[model samples]
Target: MNSTRRDFTELTMMSKEKWNDEELFYFQHALSQLLQYVNPEGLSILHEINREMHSRD
Candidate 1:
């Protein structure tokens, strides 16, 4: 058997999409820059995950 978990940050982003457009937009823009500063690979993975999540909606 295998188990998987979502990180706290991922969960937070998922919930943020429920907010109004401007709020969500700012949240995303901030996260994008922060992710780049933290790690380029992290930003790549984050963008990929974001695409998958949004595609489902």
Candidate 2:
């Protein structure tokens, strides 16, 4: 897997309490970007994040 996807996965696993609005925005941005590069397994993870992001709205 690419480092971009790896880092993004690690980021998602981390606690969100430290994430302010800007950080959270970047996390969402990273998820979108990673979706272009991920495999089937990674796609599932990103999709889950996408769902959570949408649900937050």
lDDT leader: 2
Reference-based TM-score of each model: 0.38, 0.46
lDDT, model 1, position 50: 66
Error of 2 at 29 (Å): 1.7
Per-residue lDDT of model 2, residues 20-52, tens digit only: 445556666765787777788666655665565
Residue 5, candidate 2: Cα error in Å is: 16
Q: Candidate 1: where is the Cα deviation over 4 Å?
A: 1-37
Q: RMSD in angstroms, all models?
A: 9.8, 6.8
How far residue 44's Cα lies from its native spot in candidate 2, in Å, is 0.6
Against the true structure, candidate 2 has what lDDT? Answer: 0.58
Candidate 1: how many backbone clashes? 0
Q: lDDT by residue for model 1 over 1-57, one digit each (tens)?
A: 114544446655565344444444444576677874757756665565466457656
Per candidate, the number of residue pairs that clash is 0, 0
Where does model 2 exceed 4 Å of error? 1-24
